[model samples]
Target: MDHVRNANPFTSQSSYSRGSVLAWRIVTPVSWLILVITSIYYSATKPHEGKYSRHTIWGQNSHRHTPFALNSVIASLYWIALYILQVPYLSSLFKEDNTLPLTLASHFTAHNLLTFGFIHLWCRSYFWWALLLVIINWFNLTFAYFRYPKTPRVTHVAIIAGPLAWAFVSLYWDGAAAVHSHHTAARIVANVFLWTWLVYGAFYIVAFKDWAMGFALSILAAALGVGQFFTAIIALQWIFAFTIMAVLFVASLPVAAPGVFGGDVFKRGEVVSEDRERAPLLAEP
Candidate 1:
């Protein structure tokens, strides 16, 4: 069965053990729920006495403002949206006919747990440890993303593209905070590092036809530009951010071009009415 084939990538007929599948079903959701609770608790109780809370860290970073720091409000919205979208996508993976691959199932559980750890460390000013957890989580998500098919729609946006874009951007932001590097030379270095997003967005769009990634990167760039505009109204950083955002947004449009524009989902529009009529019959008894 296709379900068995997909659930265990080892072979078409191979399937994960009942106990293994049961554990994934239970542990994955539990891990995510734990993360959600802890995130809320931290956000609500931030600036805790005697601790360098998340807000404190951000405020310190803002005082020494790096080019990579994004608008906190926009970042919050992105996280909220990503968390909501992940629910539907995660549910789909466990559908009767769509069992998730073992690796992906493991990733869902481990990534959430690691992210929780990152938040805990980050709030306490353990910048180096937080960065390590984020890097590990990013690697797991990226590898699992490309290894599997981009289907069920939400996977592209929530599971990999959205989180991955944020994580990639966070590396620069968090690294700047970690080193407390806020000098002119450090700012110049940060500006140079920003181009990696453009390069990354373009390559994925061209090679993987990954419009979701392009869109995510565009939004992050726009947020960065907005934050920089307020931080230093006369600087070139905002200009660069807006320019990168515009280019990425325009290029990500779902045009008629094959692969480079609209992916298979859009191309499916080319299917004739005859095929639509035949699809129902193919399922008939």
Candidate 2:
């Protein structure tokens, strides 16, 4: 695990120990608790905006609905496809079969290449985007907090911290496995992390309004386009597939928001504030 920490800024901290690990596990649930409480508070007191409610494929608004319905549908489909693709590989591994070494190598190689390429091409972009989103969302949530200070603060905290906590857990687990040269463990952990991200991406697409989603999607598409171009240079189809997957993940983040394919017309929340306003009214006669 020291090797894993070699590149981390937190290397000076004590190595993760059984107690610290246990503490993290114990505290992780607090985020969930906050999520529940905040959800309830928001549900009870927040003004319901029926026009912005979830819409059906036919474009009819479904009142009193959460974006989770659509998110669940898409996530379920993705999960099924993922399981179908992975089960055979896992079964083979358990049976001590190595017949698919090339396939496995190709899969992992593509992932590694794509990850590194993306980091090289878009890590700074993603960092800025993520940073901006974090700041904006924090500001918006702060407004919500001040406006309704009595509302359980847990939910807002959970919403922001949940993904981060999971990311750390995933990194720690994967890092430990890699440190021990447990390739199988690392692969499994990585797959689990990917699946979690896939679901989160789905939720983002289904839950956010249009402008936010569109901005994210555009950035993602551009990144993938660049990543795929590099993959072409390397002559690896798997890298292209991985890049597409990454794009899909990015597109999903803002689907749940207001607009989407329609662009500015569907923008919502503070995004509208950040955006330039439409042209001023013409001088009246």
Best by lDDT: 1
Go through the candidates in order and give each one's C-alpha lDDT. Answer: 0.70, 0.31
Task: Give the alpha carbon lDDT tens digit for every residue of 1-285 in model 1.
Answer: 645644554332125566766777788788888988887776655546535545543454464477777786776677788889889756754665334334466777787898888777766777788889889988987887766543445655677778788778878777777887767887788778788889988877776667677888899999899888998898878888899999888877762244765465434222222223112211223
What's model 2's overall lDDT?
A: 0.31
Please list the residue runs of candidate 1 whose C-alpha ends up more than 4 Å from where it truly belongs after superposition. 1-14, 47-64, 101-103, 255-285
Taking the tens digit of each residue's C-alpha lDDT, what string does model 2 give over 164-244? 222222232223322442344543543344344345434444443322223332333333234334423453322433454
What's the TM for model 2? 0.26
Question: In TM-score terms, which candidate is top?
Answer: 1
Native-vs-model 1 lDDT? 0.70
What's the distance in Å from true for residue 30, model 2?
30
